[model samples]
Target: MPLYFYSTREPYGEFSNFALYGVKIDGEWWPTTEHYFQAQKFEDAAYRRKIRDAHSPKLAADLGRSRRVPLRPNWESVKDDVMRACVLKKFETHSDLRELLLSTGDEEIVENAPGDYYWGIGKDGSGKNMLGKILEEVRAKLKNAAC
Candidate 1:
């Protein structure tokens, strides 16, 4: 059966970007993958830092969802790559998370966000689920690297 994940409080919660795993990328520490992913939507360095330093992932998400700061022109095309890098780095930085992800043994991963049709399975299950697909890709990479 597929592994369904969404809320940070649920089973397999670590798989959610909102989970408390921090990742260091480009010499800076992000509080969570959600912060980093959200911050990447903008081109302003200061705005990005604001999102990065936000007290919580929910706040960072709120900042990211704001259209006050225009998004990078290529955000649409580069978002998946950004998420992939963040997820990979998060798992790489945390050994316990790596093991937990690998222990799933190839079960399909799904981000069960009812309102996010792009990165999750929407209410009707017709969403693209890009985040889940990225997690599976990262899982495969980690499995191969253990060889």
Candidate 2:
């Protein structure tokens, strides 16, 4: 069976970007993968900082989705890589999260986000679930490193 995750209150919630896992990247600490991923959408350092310092992941996402500040032209091309890096760093930083991810043992991970079709399974379950794919990729990398 696939592992479905969405809210931070549910099982496998740790896999969600909204989970409370802080990662240090580029000499700065991000409160969660959501914060890091959202902030990277822009080239503007000040704007990035604003997203990074958001009080919560949801607020950071809101800021990221805002078009007020133009996204970096390369955002679409590089978003997956950025998410991969953030997820990898997050799992790498927290041993408990690593163990929990590995415990799934090759199960297909799905982000059960009804509203987000790209990073999750949409309402009809046809969404791309890119976040789940990224987690699985990170799981494989961590598993291999442990061998």
Candidate 3:
């Protein structure tokens, strides 16, 4: 089974009823997608800032608005580290994130963005599914740490 989420109130596609942000987990509202995204940003501050700063003002603004960072080519290898950084910051402060992840019970959690080949399993389910894989790994790490 695949766990699903969408940032907005009206969930997208198959997640249409599984909205992420406002859902309650562990008696608390779940953190927004931006919360996770912002936390992940700290994982590679220098690189993210360098790219944003080096770009033209318009591009920089666009990047900020899009919240999309230019990552290292070996991002897949470092993705777990990024997720770990996010989990460390949010696990205690945002219990909802932690509890929700734990509740997945070994199922893959997919972001399900139709066009996001890197972070999502595409509509046809042909994409790399990197983000889902990272989430599972992070969940396992957290579970082990709790042991």
- Each prediction's RMSD over C-alphas, in Å, is 0.5, 0.5, 8.3
| Best-first order by lDDT | 1, 2, 3
lDDT of the candidates, in the order given? 0.97, 0.96, 0.51
Error of 1 at 51 (Å): 0.2
- TM-score for all models, in order of appearance: 0.99, 0.99, 0.54
- Candidate 2 on 28-136: residue-level lDDT in tens? 9999999999999999999999999999999999999999999999999999999999999999999999999999999999999999899999999999999999999
**lDDT tens string, model 3, 1-147?**
777654444332222212233322224332332333332333466544543343233343244334355444665576556544443444444466677677778787787768767667677877776666766777787789889
Candidate 2 yields a Cα-based lDDT of: 0.96
Runs of candidate 2 with Cα error greater than 4 angstroms are: none
lDDT of 1 by residue, 27-112 (tens): 89999999999999999999999999999999999999999999999999999999999999999999999999999998999999
Give the Cα error of residue 75 in candidate 2, in Å: 0.3
Best prediction by lDDT: 1
Pairs clashing in candidate 3? none
